[model samples]
Target chain A: MKARVHVMLKTGVLDPQGEAVRHALGAMGFDKVEGVRQGKVIDLELAEGTTEAEVAEMCEKLLANTVIERYEIDLD
Target chain B: MKARVHVMLKTGVLDPQGEAVRHALGAMGFDKVEGVRQGKVIDLELAEGTTEAEVAEMCEKLLANTVIERYEIDLD
Candidate 1:
């Protein structure tokens, strides 16, 4: 099985890295850019029979900082 | 308009950060993990009427390093 996780900052949290990118884009004349939020995507190759709950546990324990970030999991 | 860019290291490239995560998961007893590849997801809020080609250009010019990385753009 393969699992993909998308980890993103909570809406209220400040993202300096994303801010930097937005600034850079503005400087480059991509003025249509109004906002930017950067996040992480982790693709995991797992042994057969791996469960979504197990993946969620991994996110809660290590993959995401639950306090300020949120994660979504997709299995394939 | 909104655009999402997924930037990932090309296949066969060394992903040390992903390797480290896999090792850590093993240490935490998530033995079913076979491999992990980490990447970036950048979400952009754009002005009205922004075209997909414009977003692709952004990826080519600034969002991704074409030498080692590839990017997929999704416009909404």
Candidate 2:
């Protein structure tokens, strides 16, 4: 089985990196780009039968900085 | 309109950050974790009617390091 976790900065938190990207885009003449929010994706190959519960635990414990980020999980 | 770009390392390339996260997960007792790959997500708020082609161009020109990364774009 596999699990994909998408971790993103929570709304209302400042994202300097994202701001930088937006600025870069504007400078490159991609002026139509209004905002950019950067995030991370963690792709995990799990042992058979590994549950979503355990993956969520991983997100909470290590994969995401829950104070400033929130995560979504997709299983396959 | 909005678009999401997912950028990932080419399979043959090395990913030290992914390796570091894998090590941390193992140390934290996620022994069932067989592999871990890390990537980035860029969420873009685009002007209405922004085409996928423009977003793809952005990926090639700025959003991703084309020599070492490949990107997938989703528009909505």
Best model number under lDDT: 1
List residue ranges in candidate 2 displaced over 4 A. none
Whole-model lDDT values for every prediction: 0.96, 0.94
How would you encode candidate 1's per-residue C-alpha lDDT over A1-76 as one tens digit per residue? 8999999999999999999999999999999999999999999999999999999999999999999999999999
The estimated TM-scores of all candidates read: 0.98, 0.97
lDDT of 1 by residue, B1-76 (tens): 8988999999999999999999999999999999999999999999999999999888999999999999998888
* Candidate 2 lDDT over residue span A1-76, tens digit each: 9998999999999999999999999999998999999999988989999999999999999999999999999999
Per-model DockQ: 0.91, 0.90
lDDT of 2 at A11: 100
Error of 2 at B73 (Å): 0.3
Q: Model 2 Cα displacement at B33 (Å)? A: 0.5
Interface RMSD of 2: 0.7
lDDT of 2 by residue, B1-76 (tens): 9999999999989988888888999999999898888999999999998999999999999989999999999999
